[model samples]
Target: MDKKHLQTPSQTIGPFFAYGLTPTQYDYEFKSWVDNNMVADIDAPETIEISGTVFDGEGQAIDDAMVELWQDDGEHKLYGRFGTGTEENNRFIFKTIKPKSVNGQAPFINVILFMRGQLLHTYTRIYFADESSLNASDKVLNSVDAKRRNTLIAEKVGQKYSIDIHMQGQKETVFFDL
Candidate 1:
């Protein structure tokens, strides 16, 4: 009989992977492939900052969570990743340009959240609260119940956009399976 090595079963999501995935955040010698800045040119006129914190069921901040943002506005495709532990208040901050509406859809950024307890990452969107007219016409935004739509909108706080993500509880952010 021939002996074959079998692959190990998949494990739950991590607080372990942070050292490798976000080396800089964990004070490692090497830098991570992606660090929160999505803009290639920081001086770009459209550059903006998006910041937020992830909260658990009990509303405590998730200090070890990782957040990724993806946005494509026909011309530029931007991506950013940030570990909450790197921020003073356990928040994730991304520097990127405000995406333009794509194919008439509301301008939004796709968010993927990774945390220790989650078996799989959660997906969500950050819609601009100021884009009321555009958001109202967006089919995807409208698909979510009107009452719960606010969970996905990022409010303009001073010069930056802010949106808090609730893993569970009354104000839980709306996560999509996709």
Candidate 2:
């Protein structure tokens, strides 16, 4: 063990996150070069748009936060990434095909939230509302309370899905350890 190489404590997700995480999506010269894309194939099954907001413990929107989604690309492909651009730090959207099960588990989109005041990114999941039956038996979902589990489930809109992320307070989304 080298004493001079001690690890530093985690810090808040600061201003530079946009440039580092989703420069093209969040910032651009003439127009945004990146989008909140979810599917890579036009033939993907159940493609839909997902939109939501990120609220703090005090119920305030966090416009600077960056949301990222990772999931199986509705194919045999292992995983994919989407930079859910910060919609004025109030909301983010991901236009993607619904993912299938991975390793016999319930289908879900793994989410990473980077925001100010959080020393480390928060990890959560976005489960489809249509898959309520499957969500009931998910090992990860089962770990949480029956009532609180709803926090992880998205609500299906007409042609899109909605899933908000509550950072704290009573209806806080279930976060996981990485």
Q: What is the C-alpha lDDT of each candidate?
A: 0.87, 0.75
lDDT of 2 by residue, 40-145 (tens): 5456666688888888889987777777777764563323333434465567877787777777678888888777778888899899889877887789999998
Highest TM-score model number: 1
User: TM-score of model 1 relative to the true fold?
Assistant: 0.90
Residue 54 miss distance in model 2 (angstroms):
0.4
Tell me how far the alpha carbon of residue 3 in candidate 1 is from the true structure, in angstroms, after superposition.
26
CA RMSD of each candidate after superposition: 4.2, 3.7
TM-score for each predicted model, relative to the true structure: 0.90, 0.81
How well is each residue in 26-81 modelled by candidate 1, as lDDT tens digits? 78887788888898645668778899899999989999888989888888888888
